[model samples]
Target: MSTAPKTSIIPREVDALKACTQGATYEGVIMPEDLPRLAAAVVSIQREMTGKVRFFRDESNYRMVTAELHTVVSVQCQRCLSALDYQLRAEMDLAIVVSEGQLESLPKEFEGWLLDESGSADLYEAIEEELLLALPIVSYHDQADCSASGQYSTGDFEEPLAEKKNPFAVLGDLKLAGKADSTDKESE
Candidate 1:
C-alpha cells in the first residue's frame, strides 16, 4: 500500500481502495461545497461527510472495497414544503474491476466497480454515488411536523364512496333487448 497522504480530505489523484493494503482502512472527510454534483441536490450542507474505505480480498479472492459514509444536509420536505435537515448515510460494497468485461468473472454477490484502463476510480465520485443513492425518493416530515397532516383526514378514514350507475349500463340493456328480438325471430 502506498503511504497515505497527510490530509483529512481524500486525495483526488489517489486510487482509494487500490492504495490501501489488504485489511487496511482509509478514512477521510468530504466537504459538500467542494462537490458541485452533490451540492446541487441539497439546499445546504450541515456537516462534512466522514467516510472510510476498506480494501480486502473476498472469499473468491476478488479485490473488494467497502465504503461507509455519513453526513447531513438540508432539503425541501415534501410533507411541510419547508427546508428540513436530513441525515445521510450510505454503505457500498464493490468488486474492483479494470473493465466492464471483467464483471462477468466476479461473483454475483458483489457489485462491479469499473475503473479506467489505469485501474483507478475517482474516490470522490464513487462516494458521491453512494450518497446519492442514500437520498430519499420522497422525503417527508413526521406527521407531527407536517403542516397539512391533520387537515384532510379525521381520526377515521375516508367514507366509502357513493355507488353510481355506470355510463355503459344503457348499452347492456340495449344488448339484452337485441337478444330478446333475436330469440323471438328464432321462435317464429
Candidate 2:
C-alpha cells in the first residue's frame, strides 16, 4: 500500500493557538544534527529519528500537544566504556501555557509548556526534553554483551589480600632494638 510522503523539516517553532485551532499534525524525520542537546548526550545517532506530533484543543479547552518519538542512538556502556546501541522512544502530553501562573492551573493529566515571549512554543525544545527524560540515567550492555560485566565488585575479592603491617609496630620494634644496643654499650 502506498503511504503519504512525510515532511522531513518540521518547523522549529509554532504558534500554539493557530496549530491547536487547525488541529495540525506533523510527521517527519528529524536529523541528528538538528537536535544538539540530544546529540551531546549520546555518542552518536544511528539514523534520523522519526516522530509525529499532534496539536489540538483538549476536552477542557486547553491547547495541548502529544508527541511520539523514536530513534536508535549510540552511547557508551558505563561498564565497559564501549559503544552500545540504545533504542530510545519518548512520548509526551503537554499543554501550552503562556506563563508560570497558568502552569499551576494545568490539569494533572497534562504537563505545561510555557510559551516564549514571542507567543510561540518551540517544538524542537519540547521534543529534545522528552528524549532527554527518556534516556537511561546510566547505560550498560547486557552481561552477555559487556566486556567488563563480571569484573566489578563491592565485597571482598576471591583471593585473600596480603597481610597489612602497621607503621607504629615497626617503629616500636626499632625502639626496643635501640634500647638493647644502648644497654649493651653501657655494659661495655
Candidate 3:
C-alpha cells in the first residue's frame, strides 16, 4: 500500500482563505494491510467505496473530494430480511478549517490546511466519510441492475408511510380503565 501526500494548495495563511488547489489523483487497489484503520471508521460501509479519489482544496477552506468508486453495499430490504447489494455512486465536498493549534500539531512535511489536524488524519477516513455521508440511509439495487438470477429488485421493499400508534397509548387507556373501575366499585 502506497501512502501519497495530498497535492493541494499550501496553507500559508492561518486565518484567511487561500487559492483553491487540487490534490493528486489516486488510482489502484488498496491492499488488505491498509484497510484496518479505514475499515474501523467505515465499518460495514466499506463495501461502498473502491476507486480513485480526486480532491481539490479551495480558497474558502472548502475541500472537494471526488471519487469514481464502484462497490456493492450490503443492505437489507425493508420488505424482506434478505440481504441485497446496492451499487452506490457517491460525491462530496468538505469544508476543512485549519487552525493554528492544528497546524502546530502536525509534522513539518504535513504542514498544510488539508494535512494539518489533531493527530494524523487518514486519507481513507476522509474519503470514506465523504462517501458515506452522500449515500442514502437506505438503498437497494434496482431490478435492471440486479444479478442475472433475478435476485434484487427496488420494488421488493416499501417504506412504512403510516404513523404507528404509540405503545404508551395502551397504558394510558389501561389507567383510564382502572380509574373507571375504581369509581364503579366505590359506587357499589
Candidate 4:
C-alpha cells in the first residue's frame, strides 16, 4: 500500500481505479459552502468538515475505498424548533464498481460505489452522502439543555372531548338505505 501526501484542498473528482492501483490516501478539510447539497439540508454548518479517504486493492483483489468524516452542523430541534449544533461522524467501506451489475456481486462487508462514465467519482458526493446518513432522524439537544424539555405528554392536548363522527359512517348509511330499498321492492 502506498501512502499519499496529505493535501489541504480535497479534489472534487477522483479516479478510483487509479487510486486503488496506486493505493492513494487523501485527507483534507472541506468548506461547508462548497457542499451545496449538505448545506441545504441543515440550518447552517458550525464548522468545516475534516475527512480522510483511502483507496486500495483489498485482499480479495477488489478495488476498495474507506472514508471517514467529521463535522458539526446546525439543525433545528424537532421538539422546540430551535437551532442545535449536531456533530456528524461518518465512516464508509465500499467496493468500487463500474456498473450496476457489479453491485449485486459485492461482498457483504462492502457496499458498492458505481463509477460514472467519466471513469472518476465525485469525492464530495461520497462524503456528503455519508454525512447525510449520519444525521439523526430526529435532532434534539440534551434534555437538560433543551428549552422545551419536561413538556412531553402522550395524551391529547386538545380542548375538552367533543363528539366525532366516523369518516366511514356515510358509506354505512348508504349501504343500509340500499338494503331497505331492496326489501321494500321485494315486499311490493
Index of the highest-lDDT prediction: 2
Q: Against the true structure, what is each candidate's TM-score?
A: 0.72, 0.78, 0.42, 0.75
What are the per-model numbers of colliding residue pairs?
A: 0, 0, 0, 0
Model 1, global lDDT: 0.79
How does model 2 fare in lDDT?
A: 0.88
Candidate 2 Cα errors over 4 Å, as ranges: 1-7, 154-188
The whole-model lDDT of each prediction reads 0.79, 0.88, 0.50, 0.88
Among these predicted structures, which one has the highest TM-score? 2
| Candidate 1 Cα errors over 4 Å, as ranges | 1-7, 16-24, 154-188
Ranking by lDDT: 2, 4, 1, 3
Structure candidate 2, residue pairs in collision: none
- Those runs of model 3 whose alpha carbons end farther than 4 Å from true positions after fitting are 1-23, 31-48, 56-64, 100-120, 140-188
Q: Model 4, range 4-54, lDDT digits (tens) per residue?
A: 976597788888899999999988899898888889899999888999999
Q: Model 4: which residue pairs collide?
A: none
lDDT of 4 at 102: 85
Candidate 4, residue 156: the lDDT equals 64
Superposition TM-score, candidate 2 onto the true structure: 0.78
